[model samples]
Target: MKHILRTSMLVILIIILAACANDEATSNEEGNKDEGADEELKIFTTVYPLQYFTKQIAGDQASVESILPPGSDPHTYEPTTKEMVEIAEADAFIYNGAGLEPYAKQISDSIKSEDIKILEAAKGIDLEAHVHNHEEEGNEEGAHEGHNHGDQDPHVWLDPISSVQLAEHIKETLVELNPEQEEAFTKNFEELKGELEILDQEFHSQLEDLPQNKFIVSHAAYGYWEQAYGIEQIAVSGLSPTNEPSQKELENIIEKAEKHNLNHVFFEQNVTPKVAEVVRKEIGAETLRLHNVAVLTEEDIKNEETYLSLMKHNLEQLTKALSNSKSGDSSESEEQSDSDHGHSHGGDEEAQKIYDGYFEDSQVKDRPLSDWEGDWQSVYPYHEDGTLDEVYTHNAEDSEDMTAEEYKEYYEKGYKTDVDRIVIDGATVTFYKDGEEKFGEYTSDGYEILAYEVGNRGVRYIFKLKEEKEGLPQYIQFSDHSIDPTDADHYHLYWGDDREALLDEVTHWPTYYPSDRSGDEIVHAMMQH
Candidate 1:
């Protein structure tokens, strides 16, 4: 009887230990939900950098996630399923606000999470898009009378002054969440602010020696930098890097590149390189990197380089590129500009000829592929079957023979790489994701490529179809979430039934207009001043 009782007591003790272990695990999860649980600091942002900043300050104690994906364009990146979950669960979400991140509105609309704090990082600064004083020229004078994003340049991070504001806002949010770290975060922010101040001084002092006043940038996000540094940056697009420049604007850029003795054209690794390539080829100028500071790539982040290092690199590149321009290496380009400028020089004329021929030979879709049918091809955008559209299998006919190979090639070229997936039909070309089979299509105006490949195609332009509305082109381009350059290219699009316009409705630009500041007065100042 004594031995049995002892055995029973041992069994009971073992059971109690197991139950206690299970309860502890359960508490780790439900612990936060306890009535007296210490509230967690929730830091939400739209880009990766915001998360990086928050992580440094919060260490392991805070919850932080910037909703944007790695290698995704912040200008238009929408929320994902996981991101939606985070947004709803977050205590405070920080975004580089001002109409900078376009999807800010969409995320706000979709998520119904109550008491979630939303903070705009670009909160305090007044903004203007990267545009020249077009204000001088009235709307009647053919200014860019387009959509609603009037002069708001969202690249607050590019300017240290603005970055200070963003960092301070972030600190304030942290204080509200974990007041214990208020002193630590404030100290960290001040130190970070000092580094930024030094960067500002470096840029101003290093660029101070340049004989030129104006230079071209990859996009309009650098306006704050230009404003702060007293130099002008003519960019391809406003507030977004994906917007393509018009052929006219391109010509203007080429014309001015030579006219001003501009040495170095620049590109951003995070965005497409097509615009940069175009600028580089047009003037035959070398290209360099200007870190936009939105998010670092896997390579950049892994290298242990911070925003300060990248900014320093940009300064060095700018110095090297600008210094080269003054050395008189391309007298031929300038001389050619002098002779054929205004009337169209040899290069300008050649560019025009290429544009004309490319547009003339381009394919247009004239009908809907209600059923499906053809193979089409182009050389310039892709190469001989170089683009995915030109090389891929097409099943239908359009206003222009569509070239999926060419389309893929064009976007890939912008990204400074090749397309990742390909699927095609006589009427449609579908892109299979490397890991999935859910690609989107682009069949607008008269041209169509629908429901063939249905995976993520790594092609940034035609990524989303916006759930497709009724009647409209059955494939209107806008229905898709792509930010491709249409009317700015100096030519009309090729649809299957009838050709459609590009982004003219939103941008009010002419068919195939140039997207760069190639012809701006600043270029003249750089050369003549």
Candidate 2:
């Protein structure tokens, strides 16, 4: 009886110990689950747009923070030690390239970990060449020979299309960092691109029919606009506000304002308008404000002003100033004119050519796929992973149609490569690399490639139908997006209904390599072709 009681007590104690161990294990698992839910990718940015863009694309999947405080100028702002520490701890650092942030390169180099990725948000963008005036230099032309004096316009985010590219690049980086959230990032990016398209249309509609084409701006930040639209930006200051205009330069501006009958002297809201006020007073013009968006004000933050809203504001001001000037009264003109206000470069055919290379029109939707059907082929490369890194090896002597220099260079590089051909059968696009159907029956989303190959090299081709118009021969325009000029040559193919004509037309197809041309140059070439 005593032995039986003792064994019973021992069994009871063992059950209690087991129960306690299970409870502890359950508590630890719950803790781990909570930690996993809270984990997020940390991203650090140099400017407000980069932060805004990352947040929009990353959504709740990542934490996007800006190093530049609200209302701080990106050009002149310096990061504190706290911000540097944050960068060190971040998973990635994204900054606007083209020399906008002086400290970004240094901070990136100082980071010891190879795990942290540093991305140039503006990478692959074709920056505009801006002319900078040196305070010590007298002659404008010869003072800077073969040198632009750090005058590449870094404010590419101002343009809607360029902003789209920047957003895509950001999404690509984020996807690479945390591929688990690629679907989320891609969906968000598409929505953002749609918004940008709408913004682009608004600009086109508002400014397309304006009477005056030129506007005097506070600074030379609108070169992208000048390139996109025909609207010329005459800056009172150079690229940076630091390049204050001399008395003679101000006098020239006043004279031009009078000649063009500009009724408003434009000033940046972020910058003090003292100099612009002087120009306005001398020219007797009213003061109008523009936002550079390099920095935001306290009010801008409260109002939730984004890149789109600020750009729209700019459009409103531009439309009012340019349109109102055309029908202004003599007194109104006089109020805006300087003492010697007769110097005007009136709208001539030569002046009109400035608007020639705009590609916004070419980006319009294609004819519905049901309307026609045919096979279209082009020399395009692809990979299993869809990376362009293999182009150096894969772009060798592949086809008879390959350019001489391209073939010889890669051939001597000892890379025996086969040319990949892209064949469009009806709405289905097939990518053939080295005689294998790497990607087949890929349906397109209208004219845009819904899913395509990319890595390292930057370029995209759009097949457009000219709609059987007289004198406007139907052709497919290959839009190249490669930021590097030396990567590969993109071409445009002109062919009618005859499928056999595609082969013969290939000989006449214009070859555009990145190294041989600028974005504007390529656009002009396509237009001229």
Candidate 3:
């Protein structure tokens, strides 16, 4: 009995000791808040991907936060006051600065904290404006940017070798901040480098001799990949989600599409690339997709899509685009002088205008007969639970009958189909979609959210602007980047405020969609919401 009692007492002591040890470790990891331990270093990152990277390197010795909110469009985004405060309080602020976030410089400039360690997450590569993500830039015509000119496409992190360089940067910073962890930091860095090395090898091996070099992407987001590899990104436009081309420029792109024997002209998942649809029909290209690692939606984040996943997805899209890519003949090698690429990435406004100008008008430059007179409106395909019950045009037009040959039967021909949006007669501001009647609910301009769906019926935006009023300026037109699914409906509809001009844009066909009618469906439905 004495022995049993002794064993029980020892066990209790051991348990207490373990608890104390754990508590001590937690304290050390978080920071030496207690009277006599080492304090943990603080770490802050611009986005979740960087947070993941820092967490891997810092382990429990650092705290991390992604400044951008979930689903927030990181590009063209300005941080809130609260975010600015948190940034000021951080010990280290890491951001990808190869022209990825044009606002990063702004945010950094705004903050007065010079003491905080800043880590520009790119390594090995330095870009000025936009690099050669040729395929991606050409696909959207204009999507996802406004940072640098054509020299610095700061997406080097997309490449594995550069990502390793980033890891090294993180390690060096951590060691500088906390010299106590020098040995640990060195070991971690080595291991991390090894992993990165393996990843880089995998990428090289997978992409080394792929039969194709060009592919369509949603934006001007993948220039680094092209520089690192042989891939050519054919984006719809140059850099800057804000750029839009004039009619002549649009025609040149279409001519290039045809001349290049291009198969696809892609767009992004979140924001609509309104400028793409014109080129899509002109060259009869296929619709492909590639994700830019700026800021992913909740679904992508939850699925844990890393830079690796995104790059792999890009490879898959490339596979499809290259199938029809024009071969680079012998002449391509002779003119390869050290040509200075003075490509100014002045493309965002122009790109947005592609959507705005065409969708805002009721004229088709290519086709003038098929006038889509139905009101184009935005509909909330997904409810609060994020479940989509509405039958999208892609799904709705999936029957085998709407083949290209038979499409002309009911097709209204060429009339620039424009989606018309008007704020309520007098109120704060509201917008509607598909020409919904404007009244009670859609009377506030505060809820303008861009939404899209993809399938055979081409890509579409279900715009919602109910709270808008007369005092508010017209919201931007953004339905031009329609996805062109081979098997989708050909009865393209355009509902806009103008009629004759809209028809003019569509009569030119590939540059615009044909529409036959316009209505109050979109505005009325949006107002009811």
Candidate 4:
């Protein structure tokens, strides 16, 4: 009996010791988990770009999550209660703010913890001016549908420089949240900045010398690019893909496509391309996709398309669009330039009388056949208060010796002789040393205008309008600089509200050409004009 009691006690003691040991181990594990949680910063972003910047900047130092699902449209996305809960619990919530994610402010407000950091990724970047007026009184479940946020275009991340700014914002926030990781975040941000600079350089080099500079896009997201690169984008839809264009708008787009001689209609991965296809078919144009980078498609995720790769792809497509572009109806005219070289506002009665006489007179069927009929003198494409956006001159002397075919060949062979000074003021274009003066007049077709000498047979030159609008100065010619895509000025002249004419002026286009010139200089130049 004594031996049995002793053995039983020994077994009980051993079991108790094992239980204590197990409990202690469990406590240690829990403590370690808590410590690890404290070390990791939980980051939440509203869109792919912000999430991408956060990840690239934070690396392994933080755990980042995008509240928006892949392929979700940022314009229409609304956070669920669960998502709000997640934001409330996160260490930091980062979003592209210039009004892109409408839910961002609301969810951020709902967070109970003051400890959670709410960072706007686009904090330091300048946002484009976009006004979306929401008129539906009943649909105010906080939707951007018809609402306009004045002077705020939330798509800054589309530009690489803006992207760099966004990354810096994220890095600054992360470093603030965890100072211990400051060095790591700074290093990562610097690397990202370098990469973005390289991307910007690539854009400069590749897009600098294309034959055409205008493109049509599904959405007006590329405003930043338009300002930065001097390319014009006519969007099929409004800033939000959800803002479907009316039938008249569709017709207008088709008309512009015809007017611009556009060969491609660009679509986005997130939006349905049905409307884009209709425009494409009507215009006999091909369809192409441009990744907005606001969200990722499943294919993009599966293919692991990084922001850099997607931007590179966009650059390639843009280049292709411009290079393959036909100059509206100027193909024949350009053939002549190789053979021969030749080159809105609703105000000013001289312009109005001319527009009505040449464009609106029903009796003059051939005379008023096109909307661009009127006398257009050359005004600098940008407001005069600044230096000329760009200037290039082509000498006819070089091609004088070549046969029409050989003249064409010379241009095809990329041989160019610079003009001493080329000036176009309103109706006259003069090449000083080249000894050529073109008197421009309107034609039935908007693209091809008539350029003549005192008594010589006229040559046809292609022209474009800033936008499809009715007015006298509606037509502007492409400068010789149009041949070089890199030139800050592609199209020449602005006709319309004097304010609109100042588009390239610093006062109007603060980001245009990304220059260091002050707004005062630009305004001064405009005053001179």
Candidate with top lDDT is: 2
Q: Evaluate residue 145 in candidate 2 and report its C-alpha lDDT on the 0 to 100 scale.
A: 19
Give the Å shift of residue 76 in candidate 4. 1.0
What lDDT score belongs to each candidate, Candidate 1 first? 0.49, 0.57, 0.48, 0.56
Best-first order by lDDT: 2, 4, 1, 3
After aligning candidate 2 to the native by TM-score, how far in Å is the CA of 234 from where it should be? 0.9
Q: Per-residue CA lDDT of candidate 2, range 415-502, in tens?
A: 1223234433223333344566522222222333221122111122334343343422233433222111111223333333433343
Model 4 over residues 1-529: C-alpha lDDT tens digits? 4433443454445345545555676768866876765677888898888888899999998899888888888766666545655565568988887777755665565453456899877776778665332121122232344333436778888889988988988888998888988999999999999999899889888888787788877777788887778777777666777555667677777787787788877788667557777887787664556788888876567556778877877886687678765433221122111111222112246433322222332322121111121122222223232222211112233335445444334333232222223333212232333454322222222323222232222212234332333323434333221221221221232222343343322111011211223444433332221
Error of 1 at 483 (Å): 45
The digit string of per-residue lDDT tens for model 3 on 1-529 reads 4433443454445445545555666757545445433556677677556776677778778887778776666655666544555565567888877656655655555443455788777745455346433333343344433533445666666666777777788888888778888888888778767876776666566677655666555466666677676776666656655565556666766776666676667676465567777777666665555666666666565445665556555555554456445433221111110001000111246433332322332222221111121112222221112222121222225545454333332222322223233221111123343655333221111111222221111122222234444432232222233222111112223333443333333222221111221222322221221
> What count of clashes does model 4 give?
20
Candidate 3: deviation at residue 213, Å? 1.7
Lowest summed lDDT over 10 consecutive residues: which window, candidate 1? 335-344
Off by over 4 Å in 3: 1-40, 109-115, 128-150, 324-529
The lDDT of model 1 is: 0.49
Choose 3 or 4, whichever is better by lDDT: 4
- In model 1, which runs have C-alpha deviations exceeding 4 angstroms? 1-40, 109-115, 133-148, 272-275, 326-529
Per-residue lDDT, model 2, residue 423, is: 39
